[model samples]
Structures are given as structure tokens and as C-alpha cells.
Target chain A: MAKGEEAAKQLPKVLVLRPPPMFKMFEKEFSEKFQFLKAWESPIPTDQFLAAEASSIEAMLTSGSRPVTADILCHLPSVRIIVTSSIGVYHIDLQECRRRGIAVAAGGDVVSEDVADTAVALLIDVMRRISASDGYVRGALWPIKGEYPLGSKASNCDILVICCALTDQTHHMINKQVLAALGKEGVILNIARGSIIDEKELVRCLVQGEIAGAGLDVFENEPEVPREFFAMDNVVLSPHRAVSTEESSRAKFELISGNLEAFFSNKPFLSRVNIDE
Target chain B: MAKGEEAAKQLPKVLVLRPPPMFKMFEKEFSEKFQFLKAWESPIPTDQFLAAEASSIEAMLTSGSRPVTADILCHLPSVRIIVTSSIGVYHIDLQECRRRGIAVAAGGDVVSEDVADTAVALLIDVMRRISASDGYVRGALWPIKGEYPLGSKASNCDILVICCALTDQTHHMINKQVLAALGKEGVILNIARGSIIDEKELVRCLVQGEIAGAGLDVFENEPEVPREFFAMDNVVLSPHRAVSTEESSRAKFELISGNLEAFFSNKPFLSRVNIDE
Candidate 1:
């Protein structure tokens, strides 16, 4: 065999259930370190693809949207570790991982600063009506309709910014009472998870003018937002892109590589999940 | 005369060309300190109104929208000070103020922090496509479009924020060469005067894809935006509201009152402009 092919054969193998977003950009660099068995690229069924390399593959990679279920775990008997390119591990079956003694590395503080920035952006966007007024100007209404109504003054705003982990206690923490307290002059900004706020109540509050406005990056059922939000100029909606930044993406790629390298060297995983919890 | 009427007659008289926006909110508080000679409220023409008060009015209040031209100053021969509720003193002729030895109290550092906050909001809004994507979601395009395009990463943006005073030398400072230097990946944000940038070249560059985008608050002319900009999703246009906030307005009011009080008391103006320059 040629030198490059021989060198590739000697590298450790990693099974990819599905390629992470922009995986092609990191493909060459990833290939230099380890061989990735791209399950999606193969024309075969996913289970059969898993079954073919079930005995040989010792590590796997996944993203936030892909679920690492118990059934998938059962198929990969030799898989000792799972690496994800997201801050949240809700998609992973931690109980099954613990039972199998498999280690899981997560996307941790790599996105912390980016998320904070998004929160600030959302807060300012909602309070200043940045998006709404931009729309007014684009709609060619500035000359005809005159000044867009003044938004809540930034220095005088009673604003709430939600930033917390999605836990049993934290879920649905911002409900009707919270909305009522926010009253007619307050704005809420959420770059955190959607379930943290009661969406139905939020809609009701907005519709009735209980609360002034909101900036939401995540929803209870993402890609399935309540249609009521569609007509509200006071609300700024994002496609769950709080952490979707190029720097964070590159940082995640580096972290995943580091985790795999540590696993191969028999060192402790960086940002390893405590499955016992 | 009644004691209250006599007391009001004894207070310092200040001429207001037109009641500033939201003047009613401040009227009661302002009346207690100064007796205002409101030009607009009078049935007479503006020059006639000014002529009537020319001999007695020693102080004048103006907003950014109102011009304190040489002709207006000529009509108000006894005016010793001009107080404006805006950061820019461009509406008042500095040379005329200098020639007449009349002090000009410009809106100073009170609005500095608010303007900075606005610049940040505009920067993040444009770079993240916050307003554009918000429009998509509000238009019910999110469900149909699958995903909004990823905006330029906040952490990897080549952004230029313009924050300088407008001057004869500084006019059209951001020209075609500067735009070319900024190149196709650059984004420009201007919260300063619109004339500081060559708006025509900016339009051409944006049309030809020579530069990435722009976020503009101030325009070359008041309330007259380039019509071509209405169609571009890459641009974010604000209606010259960078320093607008309830706090800033309050601060401006207090400063204006203080300046008038200082003029009558033989004290230094709180925010006196060195018009001799």
C-alpha cells in the first residue's frame, strides 16, 4: 500500500452517527488525527452500518440534535466514549452510558461568552425595538409615517434576562406571576432554553399588553413557535442561534479533538459528564 | 397682580422657538423656575414673535431640529445664551455665536453612554442579522424556510464603529477608498453625523457588493434616507435616535435649566462650547 493509505490504516477509528454542521471544514484535520467512519455517507441502513463496525469502533461523535439513545448505545458494544459538539447533553442517555461504563465529553464553557453576548444582544434588541424599527425603515415608512414610536428608554427599562440551566426546578420558572410582576412596562430576554418560561402564558401576557416585549432565542417547541409571536413587533425571535458562532464552532472542534486525544492516551476526558448524577 | 403671577413675572424670561418634543411633561417643573416666551404658541409670525421679545429675552431654548441661524440670532439681539437639547450644535451657527459673544450650551457628556450603548446594539444587530432574522420569523418564514442563514459570527467580525465629531475637515471622511480598504467582509456602523460618511459612495458600494454592510442612525439629511437602502437586508437603518432616551432627555433638560440659571447668576455654563475656535 502507498504511504498515505498505510498511515491512515494505523490511525484509531471513530464512528460518526451524523456529521456535525460544517463538518466538511474540519474533515481533513480530523482525518489526520483519526479515521472517521461516516455512517450517514454510507448508503446502508444506520443499524446495519453500526452493526458492520460494531466490534471495531471504540469511540463515537454526535451533535446536539442527534439522540444517543439506549438502542444506539446497545448496538455499539465496543464504543467506550461519546463526544458531542454542543453545550447541552439532554440528547444523550446518561443512565445507559453509566451502565456501560462509557465516558461522555460535552461542549462546556467554550460557548459561555458567546451565549452571554447573545443575551445582551437580545436584551437591547427588545428594549430599543431595534428589529421593529429596522423593519419600519426597510418598509419605507420612515418618510411617510414619521418617527417610529419611541421604545422603552434603555436607562429606564425594567428588564428581565433569563440565564440558567434547564433543570427540574428551573423549568417553567417564569410563569404568569412572573409576567404579571413584569407588568405593562417591562421586557424579558431569554437566550436560555424555551421550557424555562411558560410559552402559553407568555403569549397571553404579550397579547393582552401585560408585559411590554420579549426577545426569545429558544422556544418550548423550536421550529414550531406559537403563531401569535408572528404578528408582534415588540418580540424579537431568533432561530436558537445564541451559540451558533464561528469562533465557538472552531472551539468545539478543537475540544472534540482534545477529548479524543485524551481518551486514546488513557487520560481523563476534558469536560466529562458525571453520569452518576 | 396676584402673588403667584407677580413671582412668575420676576423669574428669568427664556424664549422657546417651539416647545421641545414632550415639552408638556416638563412644563410644570420648568414654569416654576423660568417664565418661557413660547414663539410657536403665539399667533404672530416667528420673526415678529422674536422681534417682540428681542429687547427683553436674554436666554433661548432650542432642539436639534430647530435652527439658530444668523437671521434668528439677529432677531434676538439681547440673547446672551443658547441651550440645545442635542449633542450636536450644528444647527446653531458657531461663528455667529462667537461674533455676538453669546454662549452656547450644547448637550454634552450626558448622552455619551447612551450613544455608546446604541452603537453596540446596532453593531450586534447587524452582525448577527438579528433584525433581519426576526423579520423572517415574524413573517412566518421560519417554518417554511427551515433555518435562517447563519449571521457573521460576533467573535469573528471585521466591524468598524465610527464615533467622531462632524467638521469641515471630517466631512465625507468615509469615502470610496475607505470602503475599498474595508473590503467585502467589513461592516460599518455610524452613530455620528451622516455627512461624516459619503452616503452616495456607501450606497454604490453596498449595491455592487464592494463592502459587506452598514448600520446607520444619522443620515446626510434629516428624515430623508437614500431610497435604495430600503431593499437591502444587510443594512440596518435607525431614525437618528442614537442619543434618545428618557434619561438623556431629562439630563438635557436639567443641563439647559442649569445653563440658564448659570447665565443669570454669573456662573460658568455647565457645558459651554468654545465657539471662538
Candidate 2:
């Protein structure tokens, strides 16, 4: 009978969990354009409180950290869809969502390019000792060590890249075609899951002085490195952190907000995580 | 006349300190075609020993390490000119050579391209963390932490380069025009030697952060970097060691040998430390 009731009847009621920075834009636009309930707070209270207060909520917006767990899904029985702000759904229980007949969306490709760029940056920094040099400067040890160990020229050296996913995008980023154009003259160092590049392959290359050196951030197991690596003079290494950048974070937020808006409008979400066959 | 004396009168003696792997080719050709003495051993003992034993030595060969120092120059006073197979006279005392009026020759532009290529490689390596990541792989630690810091990209970032010379050769190696073409986004960092960089304009550009970072190998003061430089995060700093590479040792050896050959032939030396004014 009322203008607001008429609008609500035409649009879907939505609830957002841990909204990103750009959520404000989505809130302003969705409030005027569609029926939207943006619960952008954290430490969500008990299920009874949500069920009693948000019985009308039809869609839930979330991200990688605060996944829509089975318990949370049961409480939000009226919710027909879930939208995530990340590519990987490792956090969300897909089977639970399927049982509840809730649609899911995620953001994957939006952040891949930025991740690839950061990977290359990490590789170069490790090889050239940029961060170490920075530490030296901060320590006031200028003119540090033996002239930063001159590496073979990029154009003249070979480059080797070892990774699990050789998809179109990843292929484009590290393919031989791109490498040749970039004037790299080295072999690749891809071990499956970052675990295959054993100490032997690395030691052999370094000791024999075969193919200049390598750049790697992934490994077999994580957080545990061998002592022998620390002793070597010609290798560079870092923890698995190629995809975490400030830009990636911002992009992830934007994707999440966009997906939330589309879901609340009953429109086809742009980043559906699990599509029905 | 004695049987050997008649044959010896037509030949010249050449003393080679340490030649490159290619020296064997020269040995074969010169021995079969011309009369010459080639001493291939490194660390040629004492000056007195060389003078007494190699009195007939018409030419002396040396490299960066086995430089034809003023003392060595005095020993080989009969040697008309000196030759080196590499560039950079830091090891070979140019002042001493000038004081003695000795001519020196070196490999002209042979390794400039190579060195330049390596400089770019070092820049990429430092900026990208290549060595560190590779080191991690070798250490058996996969999935390196902080592998790629977010928002660290090369495009439109500031750069700084510090050097002591802006010779035509170095100018070509790290030319601002070329860098601008690559991505007009950085500054030059030169402080080691006056000859390392063009001083007048670099200061203005550095203050503005026009470039995201720098590649410094030298400084105005022999070892003292400016106090202001200690705070900048985007710049790459070194103690004037852009040219030190594993290949430099062999290149130096070859240059020294070339110098020895030219000194005996009464021809122009290869890597002259001091040219006739």
C-alpha cells in the first residue's frame, strides 16, 4: 500500500558481511535504485538475532575471510543467493550452498593481472637483492658488500618459469613467446605446486654455474626452508606472497561490491562462483 | 753465425700474463706465422725475474688484475705500448701510465653492450626480487611469504640512477632517452664519481621524483652518499659496483694480454689507460 512496500515488493532484500571500502558507492546507488539491506558490520551476532531481525533478507554478500558457513546458511534460510569477493572458494563450503539451493558468485580474473605483475616484481627483487640492500641502507651500511653481485644481462640470459596453471592468461604472462620478445635468454624453473624445484636442481645449477639462476616464490611445503639455501651465495628466495598487493586488495573490494549489487537486484550476478551445469 | 741466432734475429718476443680461453687460437696462428714469445702463466713472479729472464721480451701483456703498474712499466721500459682486453681502468692505474708516457690499448666497446645488458638485468632483478625468490626455492621453502608486495609495479613509477661518469659509452648504456622510451617514470642516482652521470639536471629531477626509483653505482664523494638519500624508499643504491661480474675476471685477463702484444709490436695498444694529448 505504501511507496516503500511497493519498491520492496519489486526488488530483493540483501545483507552484506564485512563490506569493502567501495561498499559506500554500492549502498548509495542500491538504496535509491533498488531494494537493498547492507549489513556491513562484523562479528555477526547469533543466528536467532539475525533470523528474528533480518527475516526479510534474501541475499548475503561476503568475501574470502568471512565465508558463509553451513550454520550461517541455515540461519539465513530466506537468503536465496550468496556473493563472494574472491576467486578462490576454498573458504566457502560449496556442498552446503548446493544443498541449500543458494546461488554463489566470486571474483577471479579481476585480480589475476595484478597478481602476475607482482610475481614478476618479487622474482626480480629476490634475484637482485633489492630488499636486502634497502635493509643495508636503513642499517647505515652503504657501499654494502661486493657491488650487489652483477647478474647476467636480461637480454642475453635464458629464463625458466615453472608453475602449475598454464592457462591462457598465465601462459600469456610467462610464455616463451613473451620471454623471447622481452629478450630473456634463460631456462624456466617451474616445479609443480612450487614443491618440485628440489634442492638438487637448484644446487646443481648454482654449483655447476649452468643456467644463471632462478626466481621462485612457491615451494613443496611452506614456512620451512632448508639451511643449505642460506649458505649458497648465488640464489634468491622469498615466501609465497606474489598475489597480495594494495591494488589487488582494492580491486577485490570493488568486485565484491559489484556482485552484491547485481544479486540484490535479482539480476544475473557477474561473478557466479558455482554455476549450475 | 750460429744456426739458432740467424733464425732468432727475425722474431719478436711477446709476454702474455693471462689470456682468455681464446688465447690458444692466437698461440697457434702467431707461432706458425710469426716469431714471438708468449708467456701464458698468471702472476708473472717479480719484475726483476721478468726483466732478467725475459730480457728479449719486446711486448708485455696484462689484464685488469695483472695491471701493468708503474712498477711493472719500469720493468718493461723497452715495451713501447700496453694493451688490455677489457674496459674500465680502475684496476690499471691511469695516472701512473700517464706519468710514464706509456700507451695502453683495450677492448673497445667489446663488453659495453654486455655490461649494459647486465645493468638492465640488475635493475629488473632488484626491482622484481628475482634472486630472493630463487634463493627460497633453492632453500626448499615453497610459497614464499611476501613474494609480491601489493601495488608494486614498474609502469609510471619513479627511478633514480647515481653514477660518476656520463661518457658516450655509459650514456648509451643508461641513456635517459632510452629509459623515457621504456617508461618515462624515474630519476637517475649518480654520486660515486663526477664522470658517472650528468650532474647539472639529475639533481632537479631527483627532487621531483619524476622517476620512481634509481640505479646508483657511484657517488660524488668516493664513498659518502648524500644524507638525504638515506630516507627514500623507491631508489636502488650500490657502492659503484655495476661492472663487477663473474665474466670480468676473464675479460680483464684477455685485455692485459692484448696490451702486452701491442707493446712489443710498436703498434697501437688495445686498452690504453692514457692517450697521448
Candidate number achieving the greatest lDDT relative to the actual structure? 1
Q: Residue by residue across B154-181, what tens digits does model 1's lDDT show?
A: 4555788888878787899999899999
Each candidate's interface RMSD, rounded to one decimal?
A: 1.7, 6.3
TM-score of chain A of each: 0.91, 0.58
DockQ, model 2, C-alpha based: 0.22
- Model 2 residue runs over 4 Å out of place are A1-16, A19-68, A78-83, A98-104, A126-130, A133-241, A244-277, B1-152, B158-165, B168-185, B189-195, B198-212, B221-231, B239-277
Structure candidate 1, residue pairs in collision: none
In order of appearance, the predictions have TM-scores of 0.90, 0.56
Each prediction's Cα RMSD? 3.0, 9.2
Q: What local lDDT score does residue A103 receive in model 1, on the 0 to 100 scale?
A: 91
